[model samples]
Target: MKIVKAEDFDLRREVEYGSPEQNEAVREIVAQVKQQGDAALLKYTEQFDRVHLTAGQLRVTEEELAAAYQQVEPSFVEAIAAAAANIRAFHSRQKRNSWMDLQPDGSLLGQIIRPLKRVGVYVPGGKAAYPSSVLMNVIPAQVAGVPEIVMVTPPSTGGTEGIDPYILVAAAEAGVSEIYRVGGAQAIAALAYGTESMAPVDKICGPGNIYVALAKREVYGVVDIDSIAGPSEIAVLADDSADPAYVAADLLSQAEHDEMASAILVTPSPAFAEACRAEVQRQLGELPRRGIAEASVRDYGAIILVDSVVEGIDVINRLAPEHFELIVEEPMAYLGLIENAGAIFLGPYSSEPVGDYFAGPNHIIPTNGTARFSSPVDVDDFIKKSSLIYYSKESLLSNGATIMELARREGLEGHARAIEIRLRKEGKAGEAE
Candidate 1:
């Protein structure tokens, strides 16, 4: 790892940027899916995944799930069940109820909250299967009262590295009604447009490769999608009191995700920077994804030594990291200053992985610099709201003329006439004679 002062503009810029090819490819994939539906999906599946899945095989059977459960150990199955309960408990608090209010003037106004009729969740099975992701995606929709939830993953790669049995166990625990043995862009297309076997979903959530991101972009209007996720990243704002080894390990946790991933340490202590750089090397030797982590650190990692912890925090807000860990002496002191982060890990004990698995919070977070405006996945993603309004004769009479005048001012004669017609029906306004 290389150390740079916070004043190094070029290095700072590179750390925050991402490649744009994913966006363009996503546009193309979405179009093909919308136009051809399942046919295009099957073609892509065969090309990308090297497997052919007929419509009937698209939905995983209960018998297959039971076999999957039998393949995993009892202890692992119990852990997934416990994790599901925690996830469900946290998300249930986010449920919104439909409400209506009566006004003094005999008007009724409010909004209705309704769950999406159906949803599709994409779980990546290529590099690793995320059973935790299965829990994170399905539990929220269940909490929102969504009637149907379906899941999809690439067929097992014929190795333990392919799709972990834990992922299947987790999905079953989370109440996913349907599972698919397909993945990549084709799976995303199937979810958005629906094949003969796959039902069309109102919204699609979860994570995948660049092809999947492009596919989701292509099918966005055809079906709602979660934000286009980028490579993983974590920014740690630490001081001299922070542990260099823990910081290095935490940063590498995300760095190992991909070469494009970023892990930055912003601190006031140059000594801390030196120690962390050495610690990264020490830990890299032991990491299973050493090549991936090494490349990520060599290209995008940074040790930004600032003048003060306040300046370190400022740089973090500027980066708008996907995950922010505060390891200062009093980490909570800067909590309010954190304006842009998908999640904040306070104190040394709260590692980023906690939120990824056992923690109650959803792990599907905004990536790149999107934390500036977007938020993490939650129950809100699976629900829709409809605004309600009702007016008494008197309330309409009071506001109708202003509404008509405004509409006419905008050169919308039809809109103005609509209001005028309403008022005339009540004998409160005159028609053009």
Candidate 2:
């Protein structure tokens, strides 16, 4: 990894960045799905997923799920259960309750929270089967009280199967209703604009390939999306006290995710920078995905030696990494300074994997540079809030004129008349004036 002084690092170049071809490809897939619907879905599935799924066999049955349990080891099943429980427990805290406040004049204002009637979660089964993603996406929706949760994954080929048994186990633990043998952009399209076998979802959540990202972008207006996620990333703002080994390992955790992923180390120590660089080389050899990790670190990774802790923090806030690790003497001291970041990991022991699996925080986070304003997937992603208001005659008359004036100022006569008509019907017309 190349080490540079913090002043030389360019964040604007990172922000104004995206390939035109990617945008064009995504737009085309989205249009094709919107027009052809199920036909388009099946065609893409056969082409990309290597599965010739008939419309009738899209949904995974109980027998298929049972067979999955037989295929996977008991230990893996137990782990999924454990992770599911942790994810469920943590997200339960995010559950929102409806509340209405009534004043003396009988005016009520509050929010009514309700889960989406049905939701679709896309789990990637191409490069790898992510059972943890199953837990993160489903548990939050379940906690939010979504009635029907549909999961979609590519069917396996070469004597392989659909979603991994561990993924099925996690889904069972999370109370997901249906699983579909579908994948890629086509699956996203099916979820967005219901196919013959699939019901359209109010919202779609989870992670997938570049094609999936493009599909989500295409169907965003038709269905709500959590985010248009990018590649994984991590930024560690450390001091001299931070351990080089831990820093290198955590960086590699996100780096191995893809060649596009970025891992950055910001510290005030030259010695620490040198040590981390050496540690990364040592650890990269041991990782199963070393080639991917190496390519990612080589292309996107950086080790910045800042002049001061404040400068280090400025770099962090500017880049807005998805995973922010505070490997400093006083991690909390800089906590408030960190205004951006999908998830914050404090202290040396708080590794990135902790949040990825057991930490109870959602692993599906805003990636690339989106953490500057975006957030991680949460229970709120599955729920919609409606503003509820009730106004008595007295309350309406008192507030009506002010509302009318504001509406009329904006040239919205209809809005003003709507309130005026209500007052006129109550036999209290022009009372406010």
Candidate 3:
């Protein structure tokens, strides 16, 4: 890890807009799925996934879902069930009801909240296949009351011909039975533009490779998407009181996710900074994924020297990391000062993986500095809100003139007439009464 002064380090990396060739390839894939429906979906699955399948084989069978339990350990099932209970309980608090406010003049105004009818979650296959992701994406949608939650993953994972048993077990535990075996950009297209075998979902949520990300971008207006997620990131704002070994381990947890992933440490003490830097190198040699983590720390990881803890907080706010750990002696004392972070892990005990796996909070968070304005996936992502408006005759008449004035000032005669017509009829009715 490179060590630099807080003023010298630059956190921004070039945003990934897939290359022209990749974009064009995704566009063509989306277009094919839109045009040929199931045929194109099957064709692309065979070509990309190297697994030939009939349209019937695209959807995972009930027997497969049941047998997946046989492949996974009983302990795995217990852990997932416990995690699901915690996640469900946490997200249940975020559920909202439709509300209407009545006014003194007999007018009604409020919002009508309802869950989306259907949603699609894309879980990547192979090395990226994470059971935790299945729970993170599905449990929230279920909590929001989304009735039909569909899951799609590649037919093969880690050179195996079937979906990972752990993923299947997690999905089953999360109560998602509608599973599909297709993947890549084509799966995204099928989710957005429905094939003969599958129904189109109202929204799609999950993470994928560059092709999947580009495919989501291509079909955005056709259906809602979760986000264009970037590489994973973790930033630790620690002090002399923090353990160097523990901090180094937490940073590597994210760095091992991808080569583009970033792990940064900001501390005021020069000795603490050196200790963490050396510890990261020592631990990096022991990791099984040392090559990937080494490249990540070499290219994107850093240790910044700050004048004080307050100055360190300022630097962290500017970085707006996806995962932030405050490991000072009094981590809570500076909690309110953190302006931007997708998820905050306070103290040494709250490691990032706790939130990633079992800790109740959704792990599908915004990355690439988007934490400044975005949020982690939650119950709200699966629901929609419609504004409610009910104006009484007297209320409409009272506000009609003001409405028309604003409409006309904006040069919209049609909008003004819309109010004028109602006002004229209501006025006549009132006069007769």
Candidate number with greatest lDDT: 3
- Candidate lDDT (C-alpha), each: 0.84, 0.85, 0.91
**Clashing residue pairs, backbone N/CA/C < 3 A, model 3:** none
TM-score, candidate 3, is: 0.97
lDDT tens per residue, model 1, 170-212: 8888877588877877788778777677788999998888777
Q: List the residue pairs that clash in candidate 1.
A: 26-214, 30-218
Least lDDT summed over 10 consecutive residues: which range in candidate 1? Answer: 9-18
Model 3: lDDT of residue 412: 100
Clashes of 3: 0
Q: What does candidate 2's lDDT look like per residue over 42-147, in tens digits?
A: 6776776667766777788988777777888888887777877888889989899999999899889999999999999999976667889988888888899999
Q: What is the alpha-carbon lDDT for the whole of candidate 2?
A: 0.85
**What digit string (tens of lDDT, one per residue) describes model 3 on residues 2-116?**
8999889987777797999999999999999999998998888778878788888888999999999999999999999999998888988989999999999999999999999
- Return the lDDT, model 3, position 109: 99
Better of 1 and 3 by lDDT: 3
Candidate 2: 10-residue stretch with minimal lDDT = 10-19
> Candidate 2: misplaced stretches above 4 Å?
13-37, 157-161, 421-433
Regions more than 4 Å wrong, model 1:
9-40, 158-163, 430-433
TM-scores, each model vs. reference: 0.93, 0.93, 0.97
